[model samples]
Target chain A: MRSRRTVDVPTLVREAREGSPRALGRLLTLVENAAPELREIMAALAPHTGRARIVGLTGSPGVGKSTSTSMLVSVLRRRDLRVGVLAVDPSSPFSGGALLGDRIRLVEHALDPQVYIRSMASRGHLGGLAWTTPQAIRVLDAAGCDVILVETVGVGQSEVEIAGLADTTIVLLAPGMGDGVQAAKAGILEIGDVFVVNKADREGAPATVRELRHMISLGDRTEPHLWRPPVLTTIADRGEGGDEVLEALDSHWAWLQEHGQLEERRRARAAGEVQALALEQLRSRMGSPTEGVLREVVDEVLAGRLDPYAAADRVVADLA
Target chain B: MRSRRTVDVPTLVREAREGSPRALGRLLTLVENAAPELREIMAALAPHTGRARIVGLTGSPGVGKSTSTSMLVSVLRRRDLRVGVLAVDPSSPFSGGALLGDRIRLVEHALDPQVYIRSMASRGHLGGLAWTTPQAIRVLDAAGCDVILVETVGVGQSEVEIAGLADTTIVLLAPGMGDGVQAAKAGILEIGDVFVVNKADREGAPATVRELRHMISLGDRTEPHLWRPPVLTTIADRGEGGDEVLEALDSHWAWLQEHGQLEERRRARAAGEVQALALEQLRSRMGSPTEGVLREVVDEVLAGRLDPYAAADRVVADLA
Candidate 1:
């Protein structure tokens, strides 16, 4: 609801790029709000976008996702990389519990100016992640982050949606959790670019890894040109296997570049963003009745005088 | 992809109404495939829909959903009402294991001509249940099903989506599975018209029921006219508590009638159906580029010559 005239977009973007954390936070807040100034902000930031390599980590509730993310953030920092962490949970909606817990676990890097962390809840915006995520990623990308980790406390569809925003998606699992079958059932296997079986010292780590490998082999991406995801183990709490995970990420990135798939993926991501935006515009138009549009149609539908299909047709025709 | 000429929508609809199960099955198949004949089929069946009472039953995997549904179907049959059962697994896409299991558990009614059961897999269809269910419900309603039980092997968002189609939603839960918190988190508490603690013979049934009531009490539906859901316990495998569930359903239906909620819910369902169909049409039009619409925009996006927001504006403007 913030007016466009009150906020100066160019100065904010400049300050954000010049390493003012307040400006960066304000930009992301605007992205989350889907405010009136977002179009101007995005237009200003468009030139600086597409620089950050986004890595997404997703798993079920107790798969050590945040711990692994924190561990990975530490390792990335050790390698002198400025990192931005976007923590989102698809299942625990509208509540701060999950995002708060995610932040607390990663509190180690809170003081580091190079490490930026923000938690986004996919509560009631409908697409959960989609409506705000792509724009938020552009903000972080423009803010000079070398790598942005999109970590999600996800259960089902949100994980897949998160993968759409990421350059490389990591599916995290833990030992002895029936994680493999659950992972496949959730469709995480198809979206994963790198697989990590965290909690390596736990009972069923090797078995989980073996099951994942066997399933990956059975996948239809059997052509030699495709990247076969390596299933690695990590005791992330103890910081044991961050190096291997990072190595896998680098290899996937290299393979993406070698096959010219990075360009392909980026284009697809952009197309998704464009399509989502167009849909949003169309949906908003459908909502606002301009001289007897949605209101009359809904009334007729309620009276059974107009079937819903016909009602939608009327709405769409009136979208001009 | 069957040709429209081959499928006579009128004949199929007539046969389905006259109790031809094969015709009913074929109609549902058409819905599932989203065949070209769907619009014609929907128009033909629209007059007959809004008749059957749709009761959605949802919970986690081992909460005895199919068994409870079968029990309810048998009870409805005892009252000499034709029944239809739709079994779907939102978590399981492109496979038949869960649906097969659902069928096996409901095999007791397979021999009854009055009871029709169909299993739908939400595979590859982007909207899953949204694409197939409304029309499927129409087919079953026109097929003379007085009651339709929508049983789901749901985990996350599908549970919420299924509630949209139902007249009265029943959220099933087991006693010992942290069912209360999980149900609230999965958003069943808000949608459930009746909460059933199934498998009541378990050790913690009382505690689960208490927890559910506490949560229900905490919800915002405190108005005196609103229907407060009762927490019921069921040992469905033994066929116990079916009468109580049926009685609760009857009371809720009466409440819906007295308060005119049934009409509102049906209209809302119609509106949702209308919106989904409209979106689908728009998306298809977007996909099939006439004279270089999406292709050029995507190419520009890939080249970073145009930002996705501007590209979206261009696409929407080109839609005319």
Candidate 2:
């Protein structure tokens, strides 16, 4: 085991690129920490990015997300492609506990050098899941993963964010998880590039797929050549329908590249990442609440002597 | 119909405090916009706040959040106390449609002059739902609403945020909502001050409450004096158990005051609001993508010449 103090970023990046899992894990940790050497590592890996096909899978809980993800990994591995999985759970603080379960589920890939799986908890990070996920994807991409799968439980702002990070976003649904109206209310209908009705053997599977298709037809498709999200059925636990899902994903990627949307999407992703990082840096530089202008303003706001808006103005003026 | 350009802050504040619903609505709109006159309005209303008891209601969709909120409003008004409701839907862009439903359910109080209801959509705002919510609460507090209820769907980061804004947070669950495990997974179990199993007439009500109690017992209570969340049953549709719910809220409020936690909570809330506003101001100052250093840095990032972290550093250095 390398001591924390002795771990070197350049060496780790090189080793990761040379297919060392330990080195890749170390590099991921560095990126997750937004380490001091992040700039050096990212600059080194920039030339190697934009090669991996990034796919995001998200849906409500109990939708067989884990089972579907595991099945997808198996299918991809069957083709001898290097695959990486980042299972991000934003609500859980017990990363170790969830990771153990994930490991058990993906036991087949546990010893496979070509398949890398990791779980990231959203706690203890200054920039929630959104800020950390892209960097993690970049590390996997640079480490030569052919297809990187990013899966998150579809609830909250994180689901929308995963859409921005992935080249193709697959939204999973299960029978009796609620009707199509509920899905629309959750805002998942808008972000999905492809919808999967997992557990197709269940009673309401056909209804769920039909509901999704109906909702998609009703959605705003103002773009002349907008991609219509396909609703597919899958019995993930039985490892059925993986081929069809893969076909849909590949078709989406092809359409994106053919329409020149791939560059546009990546550029947008890069811009968002840059903007978020810049904002986080500014927040960090504002310093802690010990004895700064920020603290003073907070004190005033707390005392009700100054409004939050005015206090914010003072802090901004002082910093700028 | 008052023109936006001619709305006077002092006059509006005075009228709102003097019991004019129109003035109160206008003040809410102003605060929601983070208008130029926000400081003046907040300073004027500062003395009037901390008088209203703030209650937050959150639960999964189909868990009767809207019905329960209306029922709670009825219960509070029976005491002849004025009430205000802010239905914050962070996912929707069509605020007007949702507000119409709220108004219909609250039609009994539509002309009551003592009850006010508004829906805020999270769109076109730099500061998200968290930042805008407290100011809106302040408007209701200043308008002399004896009780203010803030309701939000309990799926995302917003539920945690609502806990910070409310003096008491009620987490509602209905029967067959996938057991208590789903509640725990949603991260609501930790933040709930009081848990309510709504739709008590349903088949699985007792089991749901039992599951909640079991989960609560298993929760880690590091603080010796930590408050134990009480699980209660309620048929909100029929207004059953409203008195017990009210009593629980009152008891919790008393506990907070006796333990001297009220001041600490309010101070923390104020600090958070201040911090969020300051961050928003900084982001705004970074300017739009059309021009400025921010745009230049984004261009570099998109071109892959400069990594996001380095670009962020340059922007921060330039601004600071």
Candidate 3:
């Protein structure tokens, strides 16, 4: 709803690049909503992107995703890397309200100045997680973040989409989460670059690790130089095994760079973003359900006079 | 990929209406792929739809969804009602090849002629499960099926989409499936009209039921006339408690009619179908990654010469 005249885009972008978290947060909100200055802001930030290592962490709920993310932030800070965290909460439909637990866990980095944590709710967005996430990542990347961690619950299409955005995707599991079969069923097996079994102190930790390995081995091996996803264990609550997880992520990044997969992945990500934006624009141009050519076609479809496909084709032809 | 010339649409519709399973199956396939004659086929079938009671069954893997669906088909057939089943397998991206286990279990109804079981894989389809499902339901509805059960794994966006298509959505859970928390996490609690805890013989059955009831109670109840979802127990494998499950489904259907929610749900479903078709048409018009204005804009965005939103606007304007 914020128009171009209401906010000074150039000033905000300059402030954000100069280490103003408040300015950076404002810029993120602008990009997240596809505000009027989105293009202008992205143009300003384009040169600064393609620097941060974007790592996506996904797992089922109750798999210590938040804990693992918080631990990673701590470890990354220990390595003196500027980090940004985008925790996408698909559960809540309302934006601007962060989960209480995540807020408390991330409070450790509240005054760090180098670490920026933002929780984005996937609500009221037509294109779902894929639409807003890339823009938000661009904001972090442009803000001089060395690494940006994109965390999502590895249960749905959103997780698959997050895979497309991340340089290295980490699929986290836990003991007794019924994750092996669940992961495969959700199509997470194919997207994961690194698998982490958190809560390693639990009873079924070893079994979960073994099951993930077996599933990975059974996966399609048609690509001769495909990176084999490694299964690692971690007790995130105790901050144990964080180094191994980081190592796995670093190794994946190295592999991508060595094979020139990084550029390919980034190109694919940009292509996806372009397609989503174009489709969203077309939807918006179609207008509301009560007026315009789209409405007329919809009415025909609803009245059984014209089928949906034909009506759609007619609308597209009219637009053309 | 079958063109209109390859098959006679009117003959297929007529034979399907006259209780030809092969004809009905062929019609289902045509609708599933959004073939060229889809409009003609739907036009012929529209009048026969809006009669069959559509029920959706969803749960995690190993929750006996196929077994429960077969049992429900058996029970419905025993009650002298023709039944149709559309088992949407999101796990498999290849269509036509139905699961061996489901095919074997459903072979009982193969010779009966009163029951029709079809499995649809979400394969190579840009729109995912939501695109083809309603049309497939229409095929069965026009074929004079009294009840159509749409079964999908309750994991991702597909289950949420299936909820929109079904008049009554039944979320099936089994003991030790970790479904109580998983259901809440997957946002299934809001969509389920009837909750069935299958495998009642297991140790966690009572606890799962209690947990589900508690979760349902915690759900938003601002609307005083809103129907409260009931939690039922069933040992679907042994066919025990099948009658109770059927009764619950019947009660929910009657409730939907009495509250006038059925009309509202159907109208919403039609509107969604129209929107999906229109979006799909636009996507096709945008062409593939290497051709058309879409690719040109994508190239610009990837090269960082233009932001995605700006490029999208240019594409939309070009089409306009």
Number of the top-ranking candidate, with TM-score as the measure: 1
Ranking by DockQ: 2, 1, 3
Pairs of residues clashing in candidate 1:
none
- Model 3 chain A: weakest 10-residue lDDT segment is A91-100
DockQ, model 2, C-alpha based = 0.36
The parts of candidate 1 lying over 4 Å away from their true place are A1-12, A93-98, A102-104, A179-182, A185-189, A288-311, B1-8, B94-98, B288-291, B298-307
**Per-residue accuracy of model 2 over B1-320 as CA lDDT, tens digit each:** 34569668889999999999899888888776667788788888876777888899988778888778878888888889999999887655323324455445667667778899988765424434666789999889888999999998865566777888888999988988783457565478878999999999989888888888988888885477878889999888798988889989998999889887777677667766777777777777777654678778767766667777887787777777
User: What does candidate 1's lDDT look like per residue over A75-158, in tens digits?
Assistant: 899999999998886654444323575467789998999998888766545465777788888888899999999988655567
Categorize the docking of model 3: acceptable
Task: Supply every candidate's count of residue pairs whose N, Cα or C atoms clash at under 3 angstroms.
Answer: 0, 0, 0
Most DockQ-accurate candidate: 2
Clashing pairs in 3: none
TM-score against native, each model: 0.89, 0.82, 0.78
Better structure of 1 and 3 per TM-score? 1
Give the better candidate number (1 or 2) by TM-score: 1
lDDT of 2 at B257: 95
The models' CA-based lDDT, in order, is 0.80, 0.80, 0.81
Assess candidate 3 and give its TM-score to the true structure. 0.78
